[model samples]
Target: MNLNLAVISGDGIGPEVVREARKVLDRIAEKYGHEIHYTDLLMGGASIDVHGVPLTDETIEIAKSSDAVLMGSIGGNAATSPWYKLPADRRPEAGLLKLRKSLGLFANLRPAILYKELQDACPLRKDISDKGFDLMIMRELTGGLYFGARETKEVDGVMTAIDTLTYNENEIRRIARRAFDIAGKRRKKVCSVDKANVLDSSRLWRKVVEEVAKEYPDVELTHMLVDNCAMQLVKDPAQFDVILTENMFGDILSDEASMVTGSIGMLASASLNDSKFGLYEPSGGSAPDIAGQNIANPIATILSAAMMLRYSFDLDKEADAIEQAVSQVLAEGYRTGDIMSEGCKKVGTTEMGDLIAERV
Candidate 1:
């Protein structure tokens, strides 16, 4: 199979980690007798430097023509970087938001798995960490509060701010279906999180999700208010399989889930439309502080490539091989600085990628 992937190596440590992912991918292509073609496209601050914009029409078109996208982190220090000095809509992250919306990548999948090898690195108590959780947060990305209308203006001589939270049944149904479908492949449990008790938008979200639930009877469905869901994540993460929620709540909860799994450097995320096409990326940001030191972890970005193989290309066996290689490497006590424990052998960014690729 020929895999045409659009590579957005973003800014900061994005390029470094993405380079390792490509190394691992090249090994996959070689061993599996597949041809992988990567079209290097620019976005974020990198694009800003070259094109004076975070994203461009040419870049977006090229990305759309590819089978899938594999991206690293974007943006830099809000305190120092000129990228941050730009207007809100012109910042690096705004480019990412624009790209996602333009591509109609509505469903985001952030899997937080507590690897047994990294149990010591987990911040949770030994008891909670011992139980080990491997949950996927299936977030509705394109709709809801993030894209809704809002403005700040004077009302009765007082400054009032209003941010709308809206969701149509179609949007809720589609993402809900994606969640249940993924849950069917994993543990067959869907914990739909929302603020239905208070927010009318969440009320509609619950209704649409329930309406969609009838289509997948094999998948057990349950609803939890967003507040309880937040508490439950820290209290009993093991209870969740696939967490389904709308935009704003998902944005918050996914980040919370990332922390429970030892390090954010180990988390991989995917954003997909209704079709099979998806954008796979690491959940961590552009760590400009550690960007060029080669100390950053590339496992998340590598795992994200595995997600691309599985979700976009439907190359399940290849995906399994990459995942198993990651697990094996972790089990062997090779660690990056972010995930380092006392006894494990520490490796730099390139060496960590080399180890995983060699294992693969």
Candidate 2:
């Protein structure tokens, strides 16, 4: 099999981590008797420097031509980076928003897995951490509050802002179906989180999701209020298998879930369209502070490549090879600074990639 990937080595440590991910992918291709082609395109600050825009028409066209996109982090420190000085639409993160919108990527999947080897790194209480958790947050990316209408104006001689929160049945149902489908592959439990108690939008979301639940009888479905769900994440994360929610709620919860695992550098995310095409990326941001130091952890990006293999290319065996290699490396006590513990052998970004690739 041949895989064509659009590479967006965005900014800061983006290029570093992306380089490592490519190294792992190359090894996977070699071991599996498959061919992989990478089209290097710029986005974020890199694109802003060269093309005078965070994303260009040419880059979008190249991305559209590829089977999938593998991206590193985008943007830089908002407090200092020149990229952030630009207009809102021209900033580095705007490129990502544009790319997702252009690609019709609606479903965002963020897996928060507490690796047994990294149990010491977990921030949760010892008892809670010992139980461990493997949960996937299925976020409805393209719809709901984030994309809804909003404006600030004078109301009754007072300055007020109104942000519309809306969701159609189709949008809610589609994401709900995706959640149940993925739950069927996992532990067959879907915890749909929403604010149905107060928000009409969430009420519609609940109705649509409940209707969709009837189609997947084998998948156990439950509903939790967003606030309670937030509390439940830290209180009993092990209880969740698949967390299904709307755009805003998923965005907040996924970040919260990532933190509970203890290291943002270890989390991987995917954004998919209605089709199989998807964009895979690390959940962490571009760490401009460590851009050229080679101390950055590439595990998230490499794992993201694994996700690309599984979700986009449908090469389950190949994907497993990469994931197992990562686990084996971690088990062997290889650690990057972000995930380093007292007794483990610390390695640079490149060396960690080398270790995982060699294992693969």
Candidate 3:
């Protein structure tokens, strides 16, 4: 198979981590007798420095033409970077938002799994971490509160602020179907999270999700209020298989879930449209402080590449090779600084990448 990919090695440690991901990908190509064609482009601070804009029409076009996008973290220290001085729409992160919008990405899959080897790194109690949870948070992106129309004004004497939170049946239904489809592949359980008691929007979300749930009889669907779901995450994460939620709730819950799994450096995320296309990236930030130190963790980005293979290209065997290689590397006691612990052999970013690639 010929894999055509758009590589966005964005700002700070993005280039370093993405380089490692590509190295592992190269190994996958060689071992599987497949071909990979890479179209390297820039976004975020790097694009800002060179093109004076975080994203360009040309970059979007190239991304659209590719089979999938493999990306690393974007942005720098927001307080210190010149890129942040630009208008809000021109900032590095704004480019990411634009890219997702242009690519028509609606479903975000964030897997927060506590690996057995990294169980000690988990912040949860020893008993909780020992149980080990592997759950997927299917977030409905490009909708809900974030995209709603909003304006703040003073009515009479007092000032008031309002951010519209809206969801239609079509938007709700599509994401619900995607969640159930993913759940069918996993453990066939979908825990739909919403704030139905308080908000009309969430009420509508539940109604539509229930309507879609009927189509997937094999997948078990349940509902939970967002607040209680948040508490339940740390209380008992292993209980969840796939969490399906709307935008704002999902945005908050996914971050909360990532924390329990140990390091954000070990988590990978993917955003997908209705089609097979996807944008894969690490769940962590660029870590500007460690950008040039060669100590940043690249496992997240490497796993992201694996997601591109599995989700976008349907190369399940190839993806398994990369994931198994990551597990093997961790089992060997090799670690990057972020995920390092006592009694483990700490390695630099390049060496860590080399270890995983050689294993693959």
Clashes of each: 0, 0, 0
TM-score for predicted model 3 compared with the true structure: 0.98
- Residue-level error in angstroms, candidate 1, position 41: 0.5
lDDT of 3 by residue, 258-337 (tens): 99897889999999998999999999998998898899999999999998999999899999999999999999999998
* Superposition error at 101 for model 2 (Å): 0.3
Worst 10 residues of 3 by lDDT: 157-166
- Sliding window of 10 residues with minimal summed lDDT for model 1: 256-265
Whole-model lDDT, model 2: 0.94
Question: Relative to the true structure, how large is the alpha-carbon lDDT of every model?
Answer: 0.93, 0.94, 0.94
For model 1, the local distance difference test gives 0.93
lDDT of 2 at 241: 99
Which residue pairs come into collision in candidate 1? none
- Model 1: per-residue Cα lDDT over 275-304, one tens digit each: 889999999989999989999999999999
Better of 1 and 2 by lDDT: 2
